[model samples]
Target chain A: MQALNQILRRIPVWAVYLLGAIPAPWLFYQGLTGSLGVDPIEALEHRYGELALQLLIVVLAISPLRRFLGLNLIKFRRALGVLTFVYVSLHLLVWLILDVQVPSQIWADILKRPYISVGMAGFVLLLPLAVTSNNLSVRQLGPRWRSLQRLVYPAAVLGGLHYVMQAKGFQIEPLVYLSVIVGLLLLRVPFPSLLNRFRQVDSA
Target chain B: GVGLAGMARGAAAQEALEPNSWEEITSYNNYYEFGTRKEDPAKYAHTLVTEPWSVKIDGLVDKPGEYDFQDIMSEMTVEERIYRFRCVEAWSMVIPWNGFELADLLNMAGVQDGAKYVAFETAYRPDEMPGVQYPVLDWPYREGLRLDEAMHPLTIMATGIYDRPIPNQNGAPLRLVVPWKYGFKSIKSIVRVTVTDVEPPTSWNVAGPREYGFYSNVNPNVDHPRWSQATERPIGGGLFAKRIPTLMFNGYEQEVAGLYEGMDLAKNY
Candidate 1:
């Protein structure tokens, strides 16, 4: 674990940001070249949203990974969060400009459809976090920044819900995503003292 | 009113009438019995054995027997129809389907006075159709139409596309093509077609009553619970292409609107 942490420490956060962003343009090029399949726009949109969700899951895992395994990826979490936001923005752009097209219907869909509404709400929650994901804001806000960043918990939950509600039928993929998000969120909550006592009893 | 070829959807239709390539037509499909993804059918449908294809015609019809595909083809006239294929998922395409009017086959079978609905069922081979094993839908994908809608000259049992034998991915050998209705209404790889007095249960409608109604005729005014049906992104259009407003009854309103005179489209949708 010490060796792995040392290795992780040597890896530059900028490298993580650079490597994570390759998919954004590569996916677009694939769509442009007809490699994304028959419905390239849809494929592109889905891929970006999926990438965002997957990164969000990874972001959620960082704290747990450090606590349980002593493998700290704390340095890369901010970069990962920013990259996730970029993918989410690309997903929304593809839907708005490329897929949906009509200006009137754009607001209509975001407001009317439950999945879109939830996704939009999630994006709205993440706006301040992305804006304040800097060194100066971190120092200025201090403890308040910690509480504000906690908004990611609900934002990620909403992202999972959006995915769950969008599928045509009862799809297991989206349900699995939602379950993982909820499980990770549960992990962050401190277990009751009574439960800790029971655990000590079992060990004894 | 003998197909869109004669009925004519006008100049705007013509502007959009360059049929999507055979590759696009076959590759992108929604035959859920094969799988749920748009590309799933193309990937997995080749396993289906369409050689000894037969359709069981029964219910209120006079000739109620299992008819072989070749025998059925020998008795009918086939023609090419250019149609605007609209999916309930807000995608659209132009397809040139070659087949005969469904009315001809129903007529040959001899409809009884009691007949009110025409129900069709797709082949359900769990060994061949991998998607069926998971029960994504009630097996043997089902679809139905009002007797009048079935007899409409526009409705066809498409056998081929682009003058080539239809590929298994595109519901080869046999499939229904109701140009005005959402693509799912046109069930694929059909094996059973029954005529009855009662309205038969349709797979999608049975699955979600609130979302998909029995009458799934394309109506821009009626939005689906999940997405707007007001416009559709035409397939084959490049990434930046804008969505066009969806036509009422998929530009077949002039021909088939009389079929639902007193009924409310929003309620039915």
Candidate 2:
């Protein structure tokens, strides 16, 4: 496990970016070749959304991994975040350019549909985080940068909720994703501090 | 010579219509009875018992009884029809169906004067259909049409596709094919055909009345609450293929527009 961690740490962030970009071309190829089944556009769109969510989950897990597992993958976190944003932008673009071509209808869908509204909210929240995910932003913002990047927590929750609402009927897959996201968020909570506060309250 | 001329005419008619391959038609489906996924019905519908089928013709019909599948087929004169099937989800397909008109079946049963609506029911067998185990929809999916719409010559009781028995996924034994309405209006695996004095409850309308209505006529102008009805992607069209503009009544406006002449389409939708 120590050797694996050393190897993981040695791997360049650019390599992670390269590996993350592989699925986009493959998906496009499948779509072009008619291998994406009956409704390829819908399939492509779904894949992009799922990939973005999976990447977001991985991004959320990075800090926990470094603290608990002794696997420092901090260098690649920004690359993963940027890749997640790229996937999310692609997902939104697919809906805009391919699915709903008309401008008025697209606007109506984003405004009217609860799922779309939530998804757009998540995307908007992620936009600033993606833009500021750099060494320069980190140097400039200092302590404030960490607080700003925490927006990913709400963005990730919204992303999960968007998936749950988009499903036609009661589906277990989206619910499972939501549970995992919630679990990840809960792991970040400072339980010791909360317990001390509770003890103080009881004494008072 | 007359038979040869008739064959030639049939060939010409088929040539004029957009051809949907047998593979595409067989694989893609939206039968919720088998499952919610589009391909679920095709994957899981093999368990369905279709050979020993019967349709229960009840309610206000004069000759109300359970009609045997074989008997119904023997009595009817079947013909091939090429139709454009539009789904409420804004997708479409060109299907070649072989069946007799619904009017013929209704005429056989002898419709009662008081009957104003034709309510249809899909077969519900929990043991065979795994989807029925879940309340994805109220079991035994139901759909209805006005008596006039039921009696229209364009509305057919489809038994076969591409000169073969309709696949289990595409509602084996018997199914209604209402060309002008959205695909859901053409209920699959029909087990009951009831002629009623009042409008009957439909599964979708019961589930989400705002999203699905009784009329469900194909109108590009009236968008579905969640999606646009202005355009539809043909099932077999490639991934990057452009969606075509959806037609009013799915391009059957001339034949079916008069049916809703006095009613407001948006309200009905």
RMSD of 1: 1.8
* Predictions in order: chain A TM-score: 0.97, 0.92
DockQ score for model 2: 0.50
Cα deviation of B5 in candidate 2 (Å)?
Answer: 15
What's the C-alpha lDDT at position B103 in model 2? Answer: 90
RMSD of each: 1.8, 4.0
lDDT of 1 by residue, B159-239 (tens): 999998889988888999999999999999899999999999999998888889999999999999989998899998867
lDDT of 1 by residue, A58-174 (tens): 999999999999999999999999998999999999998898888898899888999999999999999999999999999999999999999999999999999999987656779
Task: Tell me the lDDT of candidate 1.
Answer: 0.91
What are the iRMS values of all candidates? 1.2, 1.8
Off by over 4 Å in 1: B1-5, B9-16
Error of 1 at A131 (Å): 0.7
- Tens digits of per-residue lDDT, candidate 2, A1-204, equal 689778887888789999999999899799888777778888789999999999999999988887888777788898999999999999999888887777887888989888899999999999899889888999999999999999999999999999998876556678888888988999899899888999999999
- The recovered share of true contacts, given per candidate in order, is 0.54, 0.44
Which residue runs of candidate 2 sit more than 4 Å off their true CA positions? A1-12, A62-76, A186-204, B1-16
